[model samples]
Target: MNHQSDQYYIDKVLDGQVNMFSVLVERYQSLVYTVVYRMLKNKEQAEEVAQDTFVKAYKALDRYRGDAKFSTWLYTIAYRKSLDALKVNKRFVSSSDIKEIGEENIELVEDALSCLQAKERKQIILDSIMKLPEDEAAIITLYYFEEKSVKEIVEIVNLTADNVKIKLYRSRKKLYSILHISRNEW
Candidate 1:
């Protein structure tokens, strides 16, 4: 079912058919988990944050004005909850550690990346993304994997459109650098 139909289930839940809420959870759980996992990088913590996101959304269902898509609203909650978890756990990676690799190394890595099969290439890309800072990783995941527009991302991450644009660009560059270096190490 599409996100538009999410409103129907939401209405049912609000009207006291709470079991209908499970449909919303089943529909959105993966999207929410992806956002949290990209930010948290911990399976256990990401799962917890994802559950919390759904609970929070369920509790705040009455306030959902439908001005935005349900996925967008759910994503915003997941994003905020992930940030809160990051703050509490202090799991953020330091920027200084993300060093630039040499041009020759980059080319070697690029060649290795291209040589891999599709599934392997995807795994390598996910690993590289996980190495990035939380905000950059979230921006890349939301923009590329989830196909969220810059405006939708802005609403989710509370960044300006220009900032999201810049982050998407920089995050791609960073991911390339990471993939290249990681491939070389193999």
Candidate 2:
């Protein structure tokens, strides 16, 4: 629930109450999955990577330095694992392919987006996110969905704070373009 509680669980697990590790997994699995899925965009691969992320965290548990939040440390593992998977799969989207939507259409698209049901809106956003290049999507997901600070994201993604900020900005523009185009089809 809180960092202190997370530390308590970590200490318990380190003390040989290994079952307590499940609590850590349960608390963060979905968060880790979201990050992986956003990058890989494959259900099976994402699930596999999520499992790997936990396994990695468990194996490296004793090395956790406590300088970062447990979630941040866990995310760092997830992020690296996802990148490793990406390297193996060689699946990548080009950011250059993300066209910039006209400024005039932004408001119109926002209005159309608002008219959709929440579930539909969320699905559209998720679908669009899947179209982004891996790094951009990860940046957007971490900054917006996971509510991670730029500094925290830097640790996870191995990017500078300014790079993360720029990616977040550009990713939003790309997403807006995707949404605007999708709105027109409705």
The top-ranked prediction according to TM-score is 1
lDDT of 2 by residue, 47-159 (tens): 99999999999999999999999899999999899999999988776755455322342334446766767876777787788889887888888888999999999998888
Off by over 4 Å in 2: 1-4, 95-111
Global CA lDDT of candidate 2, please? 0.85
Off by over 4 Å in 1: 1-4, 96-111
Question: Worst lDDT window (10 residues) for model 1?
Answer: 101-110
Per residue, candidate 1 scores C-alpha lDDT tens digits across 138-176 of 999998899999999999899899999999899898887
Model 2 lDDT at residue 184: 71
Q: Candidate 1, residue 132: CA error in Å?
A: 0.7
Candidate 2: residue pairs that collide: none
